[model samples]
Target: MSELIHESVLDIFCKYATLRREEMTLETSLLAAGMDSLDAVEILFALEERFDITIPNPASVTEATVGDVVNLVSKLVAEKEASPSA
Candidate 1:
């Protein structure tokens, strides 16, 4: 599940980043590694739009690893599943 989320994020970034998937470590800091803030925001917005969920904050995701993003998304998905809207 985490891998799927990681792939989704990387796929978006790959379109905007010069870096390839192999070049990114799971723990690599995309922010520190030269990912433009605007692109990051775009990716964040894309994730929420694609996933049909709200992401708390982009800043909170700054320190995230690929796995962390996956975990957060997975947790949110699980929560949504646990409490569906009527």
Candidate 2:
């Protein structure tokens, strides 16, 4: 599930990134990959819709790496799955 989330997150980032998908790595900085504040918000919105989870802190996404976002999404997904309403 985490691997699927990672791939999906990477795909989402690739949609807004100036860099090619092959050039992106987990360590790559989001800002350096041509993402701005607006892109970050869009990415967050996309993630929320894709995973059916809410991001409590939108600001952190702007400075995070691909791996960071994957981790966050994984955590959120797990939380959602664990919740009674899910």
Candidate 3:
């Protein structure tokens, strides 16, 4: 799960933020990297699409770094995987 989340986050940053995976770390701040509100929303949408999980509220996301997003996405994926209907 950790690896998948890590890869997914790398993909998100690479695609949306136009960042290289080598330039990112768990503590790398998205805002510090120049991620704006629209970038955040786009990343969220991309995450949902890639992981096939609903994030519920976009405005409610308080993640400050790539690690935070990774954690959230991992949790959501776990929950979805654990559900019988998923």
Alpha-carbon TM-score of each model against the true structure: 0.78, 0.94, 0.85
Off by over 4 Å in 2: none
Candidate 1 clashing pairs, residues 3+ apart or interchain:
none
Order of candidate numbers by TM-score, starting with the best: 2, 3, 1
Task: Order the candidates by lDDT, highest first.
Answer: 2, 3, 1
- For TM-score, candidate 1 versus 3, the one ahead is 3
- Tens digits of per-residue lDDT for model 1, 5-83: 7788778767766667788777766565457667678877888886777888656555566666677777887787788
Task: List candidate 3 segments past 4 Å from native.
Answer: 58-63
Error of 3 at 33 (Å): 1.7
User: Which 10-residue span in candidate 2 carries the lowest summed lDDT?
Assistant: 54-63
TM-score between candidate 3 and the true structure = 0.85
Best-fitting candidate, measured by TM-score? 2
Deviation from native of the Cα of residue 45 in model 1, angstroms: 0.7
Clashes per prediction? 0, 0, 0
lDDT, residue 17, model 2: 96
lDDT of all predictions: 0.71, 0.90, 0.79
